[model samples]
Target: MSDFLVSRRFYAFAVAVLLLGAAWTIQSRVPLSDAAGGQLTSPREGFPAPEFTLEDFQGAPLASSSLRGQVVVINVWTSWCGPCRAEMPALERVYIAEKSRGLVVLGVNSTIQDNETDARGLARELGITFPLLLDRDGAVTSRYRVRALPTTFIVDRRGIIRSVMIGGPLAEAALRSKINALLAEP
Candidate 1:
């Protein structure tokens, strides 16, 4: 074989390997959003999170601005999302673990499907004591562009999104780290 041809083939192979590795790394990190409306299904890592006024489980209007000067964990989730189900226990643990740090973990329920009772019941069964709001018109979900289940946004005391967790099968350590970072900020 000609030396030039061998070198060219070697370079092509190296490029292919690099591209494959990058793709795998990215795919490993991303999860699809199961959104009701056609919107952004993933939580962006560094964007001003979409804000909304949703009612608490008690039906009290909970405004986003109300969380100013407090660390709020905004979780966009659906009862039917498997990853959502898997991550709840860890989230509850984090909420209990950090509530005293001015943390308010609010789970925004998605209504892409026809049923509400089942989702509500599942949340209840999970012993999710935090504020869970219903996005019946899906207006709130559309605003956030949540296309997947269990997308979590961590808002700092300044009401800015410090970080986002997507496709959560998160460990307690992971949740704690993000919460701790937000807590550390002024």
Candidate 2:
């Protein structure tokens, strides 16, 4: 009877392990491209980006309309996202490097579970100097139909969204190329 019980328990444990493994594999193997609304391919091109006014990390209103007529790189991200934080310093570098050249890097902080105070602290710690727009209710996120973190929208000089780049902290070459494209726009 003892041997039978032990064998039954062992079999159950093995089955559980396999099931968990299968679940993880399914999740990890599913590409981000397969997400709802599919991959965002610059469809926003030649279309004006949705304007929003939200509290910044400093508690000031950061309005999208305020950025009218400037080339802007709008990055939708959150503090909790590992890839978001990892890629920010690079974005900051680009911001400082390009601001004098008339490029604005606006970070839209989306779906923060924590309160504003804690979120502000995290932003400061990240050394992000650009405007951080709060999206506590994810209204702006939804307007943009953002499905993933580290998503980027490039706005042209006329305030039109020229391109959209999604998933991960983009490679330096890829980022520079996109930025250059924005810079070239009239």
Candidate 3:
């Protein structure tokens, strides 16, 4: 009967261990909330923006590394997103105003679930003359961790990510402010 007692105790211990392990696994999977935790800053901030080589609307190759010396504003967007559509004019204005000041606005069309024609139409309608990159399979979007439509990242001239704006219809004034700040950086 002592052996039986020992076996029962061991089984109980093993079960307890398994339950604790499972609890830990589940807790680790939960996303960290900004309020409950510390301020949740963009993962890319202070890090080099993930390099990617994607084709523009006209099939021209555009690589992130090639724009190293210029402050780059990368906007990940889809034509179907209302906020994305709304921010196009502001983005274009910022592009026009700051392009000569060493700023390049790259509109990355998240085309995995969008039609190429629709993306082109939106750009044309908005008179967006900035370089529009085509993210065909969402690889670039995923790399940037773009969780929402119209997310924008401001990259400094040294290729470090300076700021990230998510859920935009970003205003022209706000864009200019951010761009001016980045342009001022060496």
Candidate 4:
């Protein structure tokens, strides 16, 4: 009887593991909005980037629509994310090098789990000059479908997303290349 009970327990555990694995596989294949009941759809290359209006850290309103006609690099990040911190310098370099060439790098802060003080501190520490917009409720982050910290989207002059990088402490060279490509586009 005890042997039968043990076998039953093992079978149940195995089934549970199999079910979890299946669910994970399915979730991986589907976009987050479809897999999870999220309202925001993930933006992709060649798609019109979702529009969003959020306040900069200074409380001034900034809108994506306002950035049309420029190559925009929108980076979704939080102060506490290690990779985000690591990538700030590279992002700053690209921003400074290309800003005059019509490149606009907007750092979108994930304010749902971050504070303005910390965001400001990080920006100061990194010496980031580009505008840092606060996504107070993570609305913009969700719209961008930024699953990981340091996700970046390169939007062309026409407002179409040209590249998406999720999870990074991206290299300056790579970022510069993407920015240059977008700048080269009409």
> Number of clashing residue pairs in every model?
6, 0, 0, 0
After best superposition, candidate 1 residue 157: deviation in angstroms? 1.1
Ranking by TM-score: 4, 3, 1, 2
Ranking by lDDT: 3, 4, 2, 1
Off by over 4 Å in 2: 1-43, 112-118
What range of 10 consecutive residues in model 1 has the weakest lDDT sum?
A: 34-43
* Total clashes in model 2, counting residue pairs 3 or more apart in sequence or in different chains: 0
Q: Is candidate 2 or candidate 3 better by lDDT?
A: 3
Ranking 2 against 3 by TM-score, winner: 3
Model 4 lDDT per residue over 1-186, tens place: 668658978789889999999999987797766653443434988777899999997899998999999999999999999999999888888888888889999999999979989999999988889999999898997888788888999999988888999898999988887888778877
lDDT of each: 0.77, 0.79, 0.88, 0.88
Candidate 4, lDDT over the whole model: 0.88
Worst 10 residues of 2 by lDDT: 34-43
lDDT score of residue 109 within candidate 4: 94
Residue-wise C-alpha lDDT for candidate 2, range 86-183, written one tens digit per residue: 78888888888888878898888885543566557777897889888889888888888888887888888867787888877866667778778778
lDDT of 3 at 181: 80
For model 1, state the Cα shift of residue 116 in Å.
Answer: 2.2
Q: Where does candidate 3 clash, by residue pair?
A: none
* Residue 35 in candidate 2, Cα distance off native in Å: 31
Question: Residue-wise lDDT of candidate 1 within 41-134, one digit each (tens)?
Answer: 3345544456688876667898887778878888888877888888888889888878888888888888655257877788879998888887
